[model samples]
Target: MIYGVVNLRREATLPLVVGNMNKQQQVIDTVIDTGFSGFLSLPSSIISALDLPWSASDIVTLGDGSETLFDLYAANVIWDGQYREIYIAESETEPLLGMALLYGHRLQIDAIEGGSVKIEAL
Candidate 1:
């Protein structure tokens, strides 16, 4: 099981421990965005800081219905107590935990800062 807490902005956030090929790691707070279908989205600055290697490119539609190509990177994240490899999309916005990462898991959020949030594999 995984646990988290709602942020001041009322967003459900989780702690994601990301690592680069060199085994360097950093723990980041990521917002859980159900609307995003990708595995994860990290700010370009974070991607650069972590020195994640480019994996591929993908076209994604934005909330405004505009399509844009984004760079994808390969990185490892401590997920559900295990180290797992996941693809991360480069974004200028806050890091997001998308549906792909939430697949096969249950997410519960209280929708208030310091509120209860829980995630667990089914």
Candidate 2:
């Protein structure tokens, strides 16, 4: 099971172990976003820091109903005790853990500041 906590902003933030092609790893916090269907969305700074390779481009609609093209990158994430390849979209905001990453897992959020958040494989 993976553990997390709700922040003052009421976001469920979880720790993620992300790696590059060379296997260099970094542990970072990512907010759980049920509205997003992709695996992950990261800022350009994180992408540059990790030296992630570009995979492709995709068109995604925003919450504001605007369509935009986004860059996709190849990334490896440690999920449920195993390393897996996942596509990460480039964004200018905080990292988001979306529905694709939550697939096959149960997510529980307390919805209060400093409250408990949990994710476990189904």
Model 1 over residues 10-48: C-alpha lDDT tens digits?
889898899898898889889999999999999998999
Residue pairs of candidate 1 with colliding backbone atoms: none
RMSD of 1: 0.9
Candidate 2, residue 40: Cα displacement in angstroms equals: 0.7
Q: Model 1, which residues run further than 4 Å from truth?
A: none
Question: What lDDT tens digits, residue by residue, belong to model 2 across residues 14-109?
Answer: 999999989988898999999998999999989999999999999998888999999999999999889999999999999999999999999998
Q: Give the TM-score of candidate 2.
A: 0.96
Best TM-score among the predictions, by candidate number: 2
The per-model lDDT (C-alpha) reads: 0.92, 0.94
* For model 1, the run of ten residues with the poorest summed lDDT: 108-117
The per-residue C-alpha lDDT of model 2 at residue 119 equals: 93
**Each candidate's root-mean-square deviation in Å?**
0.9, 0.8
